[model samples]
Target: MDFARGTKLTIKYNGNVMEVTYISRDEDYLTVKLQNGYNITIPENKIDVLKSSEPQTVKKKRITLKHGNGTPISLITTGGTIVSAIDYETGAVHPSTDIRRIIDRYPYMEEKYTIAVREFDNILSENMQPEMWIKLAGVVKEELGKSHGVVVSHGTDTMSYTASALAFMFESLTGPVIMVGSQRSSDRPSSDSFGNMEGAMAFSSTNVGEICISMHSGTSDNSISLHRGTRTRKMHSTRRDAFRTVSGKPIAEFKNKNVDFLSEYKEKSDKISLSDKIEEAVSMVYFHPGLSGQDLEKLSEGKRAIIIMGTGLGHISQSLFPSVRKIMSMGTKVVMTTQCMAGRVNLNVYSTGRELKKIGVVSAGNMLPEVALTKAMYLLGNYPDEDFESMMNMNMRGEIMEREFLGDCY
Candidate 1:
């Protein structure tokens, strides 16, 4: 018998019957998640009670709210720190979720509309491949034709990549596409699972347009913030309220069961999502200190488009100029974005700016690097079939913030 992530089983511990909603397997121990959301780690040698009985069958009363359904939405889960749990045996975290578990936990959502859930992959977001993005984009296309909105449970790490990719691919959208992750795992006492899930549920079940990341905007379950997918970033590693709006502001807020908009949202057309395809080829190269041109060459090889995550206002020195020009000369579109997660890139401020602009490097404005990478993918996916440079320079969603508004922590 396979003990998967969301397996429903019962364990009789100390004469107490506890349902094992989730299992975190480690090298030498197993951590079980209880109904009330607690992880009890038991070594393989614990007293008896290892029987695999079914969980208690209890009927639940549903509490639901009204929402929209004209446009279909889907939630794709790619394994990340958010869905991960402790495997005591290995002392490593494992990401696992079952669609049934999600639905069971939030049965109240059935009242408003319906949802379709799928797991894109079970790897950390850092391990998310561009191929996964392609497959996920395809999933969105399929779901857009079926559901009203889509929510993604991703690791906070590479969520911005998927979010930006979807935002770019879904040109003009009707329903919402939300990416959600937690600062802590569902097994931890202070995990952001419940809050993040609630916020994502609110955004997806509502009549919002465009792709966004729904996460904890502040500590303590006070509110869940909906940020423009392209403009959001995880600001802290351990803080529950780690996600923040970069340069621009969040799209909206979910508090006390209410949806409060920061401003008028982009209206959705009859064609909800942009209804498009991604570019076939693109590469993302992050600029670091003492980086060599060969590094750029290796990534840009055979790539038709490149997004450079430059340091500080999008400035790269003369050392890698030859590589930048080489890629541009090969008709490989290169975009310049800031390594500073919180600011926009301005090529006009420095001599390096003139050099990059001279070599056909484009400024990505306030677009996040992940957004740029996904945008490049979406644009490059167009390939010989489409013009990437033209689309890559435009704002598909809030990915490209025309203006920057710097602010202090909320």
Candidate 2:
């Protein structure tokens, strides 16, 4: 029998009859996703494929609920694993685009906030770009005007970038713009979607006027950490608590449906503003051994800025100094940040660092490279004629940490 991709098959394997979703295979093994929600490889010769057919779709009963009186919030759904389901035909998880399943799981949300939801996009966050960032910022700004707060259901891969972009785009916010994502798909028992959504909504209802990400506080699902948008980064690939606030403290923590402030927040004013224009012609170069400036010459051709993730207090190999100087001559702004997550870029510490500064390489005080890139784009867009060297060194948001959090315990 001939079978194609997306075929549902009934097979006899090891003297037992079982049903599985046929994915693909190599020379010796067949890949299949079991009903147990895991992909496994079975020996092709050990299983007899007795039957194959297109799977039938079973419609689910939708649950409808009335709006609550607690606080008005908007749910902006961008495609992510949090709103994804197993595609049995392909044996891959894909975005469902239906957010009601997320809402139904959290019945308590109905009692606290009148939620207004919108499906903004349905693509994986890896495909996210500067255009999408601008569009999302527009949607968020528009939502914040009408709703008390907004919860953005996003994919974890690029959620930090989006959060940082939103932080720079929206200058004045009256309520929280909360971004949430999950490490596992919602169907998995270990999924962090429900807890994260709950925490995001809980924090959004508060008067915190900032852009933040709400995610699992730790490996367990007991609480969620609220990291400031510009300071957060995804540290691990598949951990529930992947995001951490780099060089700064989290603004708050949410537990048992309550937000406890970890630090002071700026007072919310009646005036709200947005600076959504972004300069996308920027590149982040990770400098390493044997890497020459010729490798980065093309990136500076039509770019407004280049952020270098340098090693050890922001020093690149001296071989790249000519390229760095050439980039400066081309009128491209150069900013240096540490590949080290916890420390500041001290170009004044070494002779090479001082020479780079003389060549107009600006140091990013303790900002993550990711945050530095977005912040550079923001500054270039909004203040093109102004001095970026001064602005880059200045602490615009909580992205720059004044001192070590734990007092050099490391």
Candidate 3:
């Protein structure tokens, strides 16, 4: 009855015999993972264990790193699902920063590329902060100096935010800086981590010099998309193709170990430089129905810059106009972005928008709310106070689109 975790078991449940992997158990129930990658909990008395075997210990073949004749690439691991594996004992996915474990999974990488490995941090992407972005920028700059390109393995949840922050921090790059993540952890059969990482490796060998996210183009594994970091957003929660480019096309696509350019991209620069300063006092608020001026004031209090994700074309409740004016008068920059998924924020289309802008709510034209937040942080951290408004409107790092096109929304 005391089966170890990962022990193979043959059990009779509901008069049917099945083989499952023992995960965990409690006083009232037993938990096991089916062959199809799903966990089920059954009443302790409802199943009869027919046989059990000890967990298998398979010796993995060690893959030694060697410099190859291909492009030099650095693999930076910052904890995420891409670097996580299931802990059978707890039935929970735990992240790992072991570069050897990762590299061992794909030994072909060592055969095709001169690979360098760095364990940046092993924290989830949600725990990422502006200070970490600055530090990451420094590490990336150092790695870029030695490698032809860099591939960052990150958690999918906040990958876009980090990618956007990096895009703004590094004005120019000598090689492609591709951030990659997987919706499914690498241990599962449906895992996209392999394809995404392979795509990142392939794209990194190219001459593209901008920060971009490499993810599945669709549910199928045939192709992967390269999205501009600032223009990308994680659209689906658990889909293989979660990240999408908003209001624009993907920069490129990778298939058959080759990268095909889909849109104009920044080629490699002569030298790399970074503006790592970031203002942590920026806050982003989503405008909701019945939100009071006091609510806005409380949220915007003591923040240097506040990004309001306003309703349709960036219109806030006219009732909150006084609070917006007060926040701006106190030297806190107020920028408006759309709550809608795809479209530019137009202040001249509606009277409420006009009123908000007249009182000094700068429009974050077509920039995603999350992107606007990072851009505000970047601008506030490095630029003078007077230059904030003008720079916000400027299309820096492709965050803003000059024209809207049909069929751009997903």
Candidate 4:
């Protein structure tokens, strides 16, 4: 049977009958929107259509967005689920660069801030690279000159990594730089895009001058969290509250359209200082029980820096010591970070750690593995060789906490 878009239909599937709105159909399956606002694709041979009706013609008015009287805010879109929607004809979600479509969804944004948008890139976060981070830093610098703050829309998969890189690259910021992402696509019923974006905009107007991430504070839509970029990580695969601060508390929380500070944060500064240079010759290795010295050596070959996600208190198999020492002898820097979620690496406590440290394995004090990797990249790219080891252990951009609070761990 043929039906038009928005045609109401009753279908029987697996001994159950339900109503749905016809969206599109292909050779093998039919896609329809359920009452709860989720779209499900049912195999054509599995469902029996009991009744159908003609589509209704409903016109939507075009909303015109104008600059608001408030301070200027710049939005940079780097393609992600936050900027993606379902294509009914294909039943697939794709990235979009239509700034108007996004702004129209939240008209209040233009009503409160003079929003300026720039499409930095239209690629997923997994495709993000160091070169792109350099370019993005430049773009953000330019925008900061004209806007009170900037908001970045990014994919959740690698949002933490990009956020960490930016956190390290910008030594100082004139205004807050907020990175926001959603666990689900914008077209889905349960998408967190709006709340995250709202929180980002709200945070952008604050006196904070740090790189932070704005995401769902919990499963519900009541609150959004503002996490320091270097301390944040994507903890869950598909939950709205996927992103969390690993070893620290969020800087602030946004609820009921109001912002409240939870932790100390940097106030807005007079000028933006950025070190966009990044050494891309960096590799991150997760040490496991059976990883051979040969394998470790092969992975470390020709790399300027390597970040190892080691076991508790930062330990690799004793067998890999030879390879690590050899790598260091060749002028390579190997940094040790804990694979555990919420602890610092203390090389002085364990013989293995002390031995590793003796051979030049720097300890990353409570720094998340991803943050350590990005910090290594930033340090190697801009600093001198003599200062590399010192800078790695320093609490730069809040990546390395002098002490970890017991309550911070979940």
The TM-scores of all predictions, comma-separated, are: 0.74, 0.82, 0.82, 0.82
Q: What is residue 141's positional error in candidate 2, in angstroms?
A: 1.5
Across residues 1-410, which tens digit of lDDT does each residue of candidate 3 receive? 56767888999999999988887788889889887778999998999999998887543222225646867888787888886766755476645534555457667666678777677876778999889999889989989998999989899999999999999999999999999999987778999998898899899999998999999999999999999999999998999998999877899999877889988888989999899999999999999999999999999888999999999899988889998888889989999999898988999988998888789889998999999999999999999999999999898898887875566566
Candidate 1 residue-wise lDDT, 43-101, digit = tens: 65652445564434323222222244422346666776665556553344655444444
Q: Roughly what TM-score does model 4 have, to 2 decimal places? A: 0.82
Which ranges of candidate 1 are over 4 A from the true structure? 1-75, 81-121, 272-276, 383-387
Model 2: which residue pairs collide?
A: none
State the lDDT of candidate 4 residue by residue for 1-410, as single tens digits.
56776788899989999988888788888889886778898898999999997765434222223566877888888888786666564344555545566568767666688777777876878999989999999999998998899999999999999999999999899999999999986667998998898899899999999999999999999999999999998988999999888767899999988999999998989999999899999999999989999999899998999999999999998989989989999999999998898888999998999999898899988999999999999999999988988999898888877666666454
Kindly provide the TM-score of model 1 when superposed on the true structure, using C-alpha atoms.
0.74
Give candidate 4's total backbone clashes: 0
Give the Å shift of residue 361 in candidate 1.
Answer: 1.9
- Off-target runs (Cα >4 Å) in candidate 4 are 1-65, 87-107
User: How far out, in Å, is residue 16 in model 2?
Assistant: 26
Native-structure RMSD, model 4: 7.6
On the 0 to 100 scale, the lDDT of residue 162 in model 4 is: 93
Could you tell which candidate, 1 or 2, scores higher by lDDT?
2
Candidate 2 per-residue lDDT, tens place, 1-410, comes to: 33554678899998998888887788889888776867888888899988888755434322223466768887787878775677654676655645567568876666777777666877789999998999988888888887889889899998888898888888788888899999987778998988898889888888888899999988998889998888888988988989988756678998876789988776555767888899998899998898867788976789989999999899999999889888888889999998885878898989999999899888997888999999999999889545788888787767777885763211
